[model samples]
Structure formats: structure tokens, C-alpha cells
Target: MANSLLKHPDFMRLWSAQIGSAFGSRITRTVLPIIAILLIDADPNEIAILSALSFAPGLIVAFFAGGFIDRNQKRPLLIVTDLVRAALIFSIPLAAFFGSITMMQLYIVAALVGAATALFQIADNAYLPRLVEKDQLVEANSKLESTDAVAEAAGPGIAGLLVSLVTAPVAMMVDGFTYLWSALMLTRIKKQEPEKQARDENDNLLSDAIAGLKACTNHPVVGPILAAETLLAFFGGTYLTLYMIVGLRTIGLDPFTLGVIISLGGVGGFLGAMAAAPMAQKLGLRTTLLITLALGQLSNFFIPLAAAMPEFGAAFLALQQIAGDIFMTIFVIQALSLRQRVMDENLLARANATFQLTTGIAVTISALLAGPLTIIFGIAPVLWGAAIGSMLALPIMWLAKEEKAA
Candidate 1:
């Protein structure tokens, strides 16, 4: 039976914090690349590099972050990271106001914000188990995902208006304030977290990091999920690296249209979150996961097709967004719930970290290659290749039938 988290005040606060952050984050995601493409006139190479910087910090620091999170208090880490992200994001608008903005400054901010995001993600994942009962993981995650979907649905439209009324750089002010709001909500949570486990005198950060990797790899259930996620990340990264560029520059989508299309995906995401538990209950976890993962990859075919046909681009993109987000959101919620359910609490942070590190490496590599690949093969062919490559994960999922063998 699903435990009711409605009476849990701390969980509510966390949920509240997340709602603001998710909305603000969607705004930032919408404006950041638009700022680069429109205001900075960044080329494909620069855009690829920017995307790479966003994922590289997770690749570089995730192992250590996982270990550190395992040994320390997550609440403080979450608070600090929020504050840092707020400050870093605020810099963009500040620079814009001073007429000192440059690609180099944007690059620096992306790298720093990415680092803070990596830490915040690891800490937040680890902190959740402490906030609610194990049985409530799905419900808790579902609520969070739903909030994200709503933000996803509305944030871009709002961002589009902001970008139209003000400039993209100035529009980032909303994200900064949202982060501040998230931090304040986090501070009000009065739940006492579990005491940190005693660290061995001989155990260092590296060793702890290694142990976390071992925990994931050694676990029968988590090992395959990790492998599948890493593979998907590479293809997903390649396609996403060019998505905005193609939408705005190549396909000639206006900011408002682009935002509306992206928001449609959030609507699908909300539906997916609501449907996940029921689907799992009906079709079984293994079946639901395999089907959703495959469908998500297959949905990408629309993206390249949309790019190829400019007149029908919006319709194709919208179909892909709604269908793709539904399946992917279902896959993500189930996968995360499974991980939280099976992993030992002491190693959960590290395991989550290990997943992030590996996937981050894959995404970073694919993103770095996207620009060069586009130059060599053109964006359409490269996008089609990414979509096909993502299907390679299906076999991995099929083989991971140890969850229930149903």
C-alpha cells in the first residue's frame, strides 16, 4: 500500500521547494540556449562546447560527490548548492546589465552552474529516503515529477514572454529568485536526519567512491539499469545538443512556438507520472520498463523528420514531445523507485552518484561530438543516427529480467 505523505510536513516543504525550482529551471533551460544562439550568435561548435560543459562537471565530480554525500549531512549540501546556483545564475543578468556579457562568461557560468547542479542532484537524491518511508518512494517521486511537468508545461511559455518583453539574459533573473525561494523552503524543514555513519579512519574519499561503484555494479538489479541508462544518455545527449539549434536556426521556429511545443511535453510528463504506478501494477515492472524505454527512443524519429520538413516541423515536434515525455517519464519514475527500493541506505547516495558519473561521461562525450558530427554528416543524418543508436539499449533492458522475471 502506498503511504500517505500528505501529513508529512518536511516532505511537503521539500515538495514546495521543488515546485518553484522546477518552474524556474524550465525557464532557464529555455532561455539559456536561446541567449547563446540569438544574443551571442554562437556557432555549432560553441553550442556543443556549452552543452559539454553542462554535463562534464557531473562526470568529473560525481564519484567524490556520492562518497561525500554518503558521509555527510545532505540538507546542508542542498542548501549551499541552491545558494551557489542562485548566485551563479544571477551573474548572467548582472553581466547583461553592465554590457559585459560574453561567450566566455557564459561558458564559465555554465560550468559553475553545472557543478552546483551535480552536487544538488546527488544530495537531493540521497536526502529523500530520509524524508519519507520506503513505501512512499513512488508517490513522493510521482509528486515531484508532476510538479516538474507542470513547470515544464508553463515555464517555457512564460520564458518566451519574458524573452520577448525583456532580453534572454535579463530573463534569467526569475531562475535566480526561484533558487532563493527553494533555499528558504529547505531551511524551514525541521526533520532530524539520520546520524551519519561512522567513517573508518583508513577510508578516504577515493575508497568510498570506489565502494559506491562496486555497490551498483555488484547489485543484480541496479547493474543492468545503470548500463542501460548510460547507453541512452549518449544518444539522448547527441540529439539534445542540437535540438534548440535546429529548432530556432534551422527550422526557423520562433521563441514562442518553440516554448509551446516544449510545454506540451510537460503535459505528457504529468500524465506519465500519474500513470506509472498503475501501468506497473497492470503490465508488471519489467514489461513496463522495456516498453517505455523502447518507445521513448523510437519517438525521436519524429525529431529528425520534423527537421527535414520545415512546413510540418511544429506538428512533428509536438508529437515527439508528448509521446516521448510520457514514456520517458514513466521509465524514469519506475527506475528511480526501483533503485531506492533495492539499494542499502548507506550506499544509496554512492550508487546514485555512480549512475550520474557514468551517464554524465556518456552525455559529455556525445555532446562534444555533436558539433563535429553535424559538420561531417549534416544535422539530419546525425539525428537519425542518434535515434537508431538509442535503440541499442532495448536489448540491455530485455536482458535485465531479474527484477521479477515476469
Candidate 2:
């Protein structure tokens, strides 16, 4: 039987770290684009490039990092990466203070932070199995994601407020501080991590990355879900690259109202996190996954629709945030639990790396394409195409045979 996450101090520390990190991520997501639009007067192409830079490094490095993560302890990597991200974020505000912050600097920061986040996430996925019994993964993930959901709920609003009051670049200082907080919380964990097994002398990053990629593709359940997720990731990139521009510039919502609309997603995410396990229990994991995945993809239509109707933009966006986040959160929780339950502990990091690699590639391509597509066809059609592309994931997922959770 799984122990209560509420009673686990080390898990709580991990969860707390996630809280700060999640909030920091949310703020960065909000402010970076706004800074590009408002401060730098960048066009859609530049915004798309900014978005692409964030995921491009992960596409390049995550597979190798996954290999490295499996050969080392995760805790130190987690801490160091957090510090690095904090430093990177702090550099932005410092530059802004001197009135020298530029789109190139923002691009560099986003890329570096993306690479660090890729490492942190892979290590985190592998580390979790070591921290708790296999049976506890769902609950543990639920707790962690719930914290993220709370941050998601409030982070953007706080970011918007800070941006409104202090300006966008200076507002990034809050994200830097959150990373420092994350690092501090991580230091408080007392759990002794299991030592990595000694690798063969012939083993290297390339071989390990290849092995990871093979493992994920050869697995029955993992392979299909990975494909589906890659498709969704591509479509998701398109939405993200355009959403801020569409809202702030196209539909003309103020930053605070935009933040509030986005925060509704966090509220929905919290509800989804809380409901994931229960829904899995009641509906079975397969059914719940299908329902949520379909709903999540379908919900994205609202964005393009919102752009088409500026008068009702806020209402459409709010609905999109709430319904879309709820479904996506539920899908993510159940999907992650399913992956963790099935993969061997030693291979988990590599498998996750492979997953990240594919999705990162997809996202990068989508982000790069989104701007060009928008320039050619305009915002509404590009978004409509993205929404249509995202729905393709449902059939791919539907074709995969479900595995009973261990």
C-alpha cells in the first residue's frame, strides 16, 4: 500500500521545490512574450523564434542528458540546474536595470534555461521512483502536480501585476528568486538516494541515447503514447507561440486580464490533479486517459475561435483555459503515472529523455513554423490548423493497446 504523501517530509520538500519552479516557469511564460511584444516591439516571427529557442536546446541535448542522468545521482543535478537557471534569469533583470536587455539576450536565456529544465525534468522523473514505493507514484505525482497547479493558478496573475507595476523585464526578478527558493527547498531533503549502478566501460552518451530511443519505440504502450504526445506537443507549440501575441496584440486584452484568463487554467489544473486518481479508479486509467485527451485537444479550438471574435475573446479564452487545462492536467497525470508504472527504474530516465527528445523536436518545428505560417496565412488560420493537427493525436492514442497498471 502507498503511504500518504502528506506524511512524507522528503516528498514534501521535493513538492515545495516544484512549487517555486512551477511558479517561476509560469511567470517566465507570461513575461517573456510580453517583453518581446511591449518592450522590444518584436513581430510574430521574432516571438516564434523566442518560443523556438526555449525548446530547441532540449531537442538537441535532452537525449544525451538522459543518458548522463541515469549514470549519476539526480539530487545534485537538480540543485545545480536550479542555481544555473536562477543565475540565467537574474541576468535578464540586471541587464534590464542597465537598459541593455535585448531580444538576443532573451533568446539566449530561454535556450539555456530550456536545456537546464530538460535535465532537471529527466532527473526528476528518474529520481521519483527511488523516493517512494512504486504504488505511491500516482499519489506522489498528484501532490506534486497539484502544487504546480496552484502555482499555475496564481503565478501569471502575480506576474501580470508585477509587470504592470515594475515593468516586464524587472518583473523577471521574481522568477529568479523563485528558482533560488526552489534550490533552498531542495537542500532541505534528507532522503538518501540509491547509488547509480556502475555502467560498462564501453557505454557512452551516444550509445545510451540510442538505447533509450530504442527502448521507448520498442515498447508497446510507451511507443504509441509518445507518438501521440509528440503530435500534441507540436500543436501545443503553435498555440503557445501565438497565444500571447493574439491576446495582447490581436484581440487586445490587457496584461492583467490576460493573466487572469490564464490563471483560470491553473484553477482547472488543480481540480484535474485532485481528480486524476479518483477518476482513474472510477473509470479505469484507459477510459480516463481517452476522455481527457480527446477533451483537451478539442478544447483548443476555442483559441482560434476567440481570435475570430474579439468581442467575445475573454469569454472564449476563459473557457479554453478552464476546460482545456482540466482535461490536459488529467491526461498528463494519468499518462505520467502510466509511464512510471510500466518502465524499469534503470531505464526510466533514458525513456523519459527519448520522450522529451521527440516532443522537443516537434515543438521546435511547430514554433519555427508558426510564425512563418502566421505571416503567410494570418493568426486565425494558423491556429485553426494547429487545432486540427492536435486532434490527430486522439486516433493515434486510440490505436494503442492499453496496459494494465502494475
Please list the Cα RMSD from the true structure of every candidate, rounded to 1 decimal place: 3.2, 3.1
Candidate no. 1 TM-score: 0.87
lDDT of each: 0.85, 0.86
Cα lDDT tens digits for candidate 1, 1-406 = 5447777899999998887678776776677788889878999889878866776776666877777788888888888988988898899989888888788988887888888888888888888988888768878888899898988788878888899998787789978888899999999999988777787887887887789889988887788889999999988888768998878987899987887788799999999998888788888889999999989889999989987887888898999999999999999998898888888888888998899988977887898799999999999999999999989999887777546311
Give stretches of model 1 more than 4 Å off.
1-3, 30-52, 91-105, 163-170, 245-255, 307-312, 374-380, 402-406
Steric overlap count per candidate? 0, 0
User: Residue by residue across 35-133, what tens digits does model 2's lDDT show?
Assistant: 889878999899978977776787667767777788788888899999999999999878878889899998999899988887888888888888877
Compare the candidates by lDDT and give the number of the best one: 2
Q: Give the C-alpha lDDT of model 2.
A: 0.86
